[model samples]
Target: MPRGAVRVDLNISLDGYATTTDQTPENPFGHDWGRLVGAYTATRTFRARVLGDTSGAGTTGVDEAYAEAYFEEVGAEIMGAGMFGLHDHGDDPDWRGWWGENPPFHVPVFVLTHTPHPTLEMEGGTTFRFVDTDIEHALELAHEAAGGKDVRIGGGPTTVRQFLAAGLVDRLHVAIAPILLGRGIRLWDDLRGLEAGYDVVAETADSGTIHLTFRRE
Candidate 1:
């Protein structure tokens, strides 16, 4: 069978920031993070995965539809070390991750970092393998472990920008929140005229978040 799609999903601010500068140990996602991902967090899928809430207490409309699409056919995930809490927990050898014992991703998750760490096996099928390799090599490893399913590039802006620059991403879905972060990691920085290569489509959810999908043409 052919290899699966390489996808990237991110929640960015109106000003194109994927994160804010106010991130700290206590506030891992920072001040604007919550607002940026409010639509997604209010979805049933996120509540189920992150909060372990199967009581079905989230929105079931447009936002939830996109949230459901995020987990469909994903067999592997690649993320930046910052997303895995390596920037904060780099020195701590016992720091598992931001997610407790059972992470949402039940597939092999490759964490890109400069300092390689041992493979961490969590409660679920989520195994975090720290790698110091380049993007191509990391994708190769992830593809091999995907078992013919789609590979997701779970990001922190910089990592997603790297893959975007390398022309490695096949599809990208971004949820643009109405907030303006002013100064954080900008997703569109140095990516001038980047949309020319993709067949783009946009939709607005009832919660006011704009969903944009880009598929390489």
Candidate 2:
């Protein structure tokens, strides 16, 4: 049997920003975050998986195709502290996650942070495990939890960048939303000449979202 591959998928803007700074108390995710991930969320796959809308609605084109692949063959996921809402509500012991009763990721999700928290088991097969260890150790734990399936590096850009910089990712996929955010966390900041390590491919969707994929050669 083959071991699982470490993969990552993210949504970015044309200006290379992966996150925005317009977050407020009422709108925690920021308004632009929706615009950034608008295309993927509009897909039928996202509707069925995340929103539980099995009405057979939504587009089934390139965007949907990538959305479908996002959940394929993955048994475990690793995310950053920010991705788990720890940065905002770390003190709230009752704060589970942004996903509510049940998160879309049914697999085990390991959250990397400087602090540790108790494991949270949700309604579905999802289990949230906090890791205060390093990136490589987190991947090791995720791989074990995956049970032979692929391990996904699901993130908030910073975590993804660290993993990519350490040459830990086997596949990196980014959906470039056709908008320019002037200020935010940029994905390709210090990682110059990243293409030399991976075979890259790009595909444009009907929504004008360009899907860029980089696979280690």
Candidate 3:
């Protein structure tokens, strides 16, 4: 038993795009994907532990339960450089992360990047360590950081595709929103040659989102 379990939690459109065309400020995605993520992150227990806030009092049952499962079982996090944004460059060497002063992840976060950068120590015991190596190296570091817990693969599509192509991901949890993004970024772009099989372990629907969990089979 390693320190962590690799899991990917992401939101996609009905068309399978994780992001819409023109992600810039001028042409933001028309869908309310941010709202959906906000709702998911606002779970009472999740917010309390991750954000150090107790304002998320009225979270629904399913959302709270899902958040608990994600956060409680996670010991470390892995993400692509894109998901972490362009913090690697620019003048701010110690930019920490995009999650402002305190990121949601309270454990070690292994960021996959090409350039080498120093580890960022944020509030709430979150350390953002950049990894320029391949997926296998990143997974090994994440598992080491997890310390017998599970490693979560936070994504920006490309990173998830790499892991999937390498046959490294054990489980995937995708929240499908009821919208269509003509084109932007897709999750299954490079999965054509992989021998991955999935079993639908659970499925649920909310106001505007359908949650689907798959276990590698």
Candidate 4:
């Protein structure tokens, strides 16, 4: 079996923000969160995986291609506490995740957080394991759990930045939406000249979102 790859996929705004601070229970992405990932949400893959819509009422172009690629060959997922609903759940022991019952990720998900929570086993083969460790240890555990398949770095920006800064990311995909989020968590701060270590490519889809791929050189 081929070795697993460390990959990350993110939807960022034109101003390079991955999330807004105005997140509410109703509006998870905050003020302009939808605008950043509207294209992705309308993809066929997203509809099928997230909404469980089998009617195929979604687009099938470049955006859909990227959306499909996001799940390709992925066997395990690593995410931050924020991405796993820690910020919203706080100390709620019953909070499983924002994704009810069956989550879109049908694999083992290792959540990085300081708060230790019991392992959660949900429907569709999704298991949530919380770890309070560094990026190296987290990746080691995720890689082991990956079982020789690709490991996806699911994000809310902060976690991805930490992995990238630590040079543990092998491949990165970022979709840049055509909007400016003046206030939010920026993804490219203090990471100047970060593209030098990767073979980069950029494509602009019809939805006006630029999809960027960075493969380690």
C-alpha lDDT values of all predictions:
0.92, 0.92, 0.75, 0.89
Q: Give the TM-score ranking, best first.
A: 2, 1, 4, 3
Query: Native-vs-model 4 lDDT?
Result: 0.89
Stretches of candidate 1 exceeding 4 Å from the true structure: 24-29
Which sections of candidate 2 miss by over 4 Å? 25-28
State the local distance difference test value for candidate 2. 0.92
Per-candidate alpha-carbon RMSD to the true structure? 1.6, 1.4, 2.9, 1.7
How many steric clashes does model 1 contain?
A: 0
lDDT (10s digit) by residue, model 1, range 1-54: 578999999999999998878788898767777898999999999898778898
Worst 10 residues of 4 by lDDT: 27-36
Q: Which stretches of candidate 3 lie over 4 Å from their true place?
A: 1-3, 21-31, 35-56, 87-91, 193-196
Candidate 3 has an lDDT of 0.75
Cα TM-score of candidate 2: 0.95
Candidate 4 residue runs with Cα over 4 Å from true position: 22-31
Error of 4 at 93 (Å): 1.9
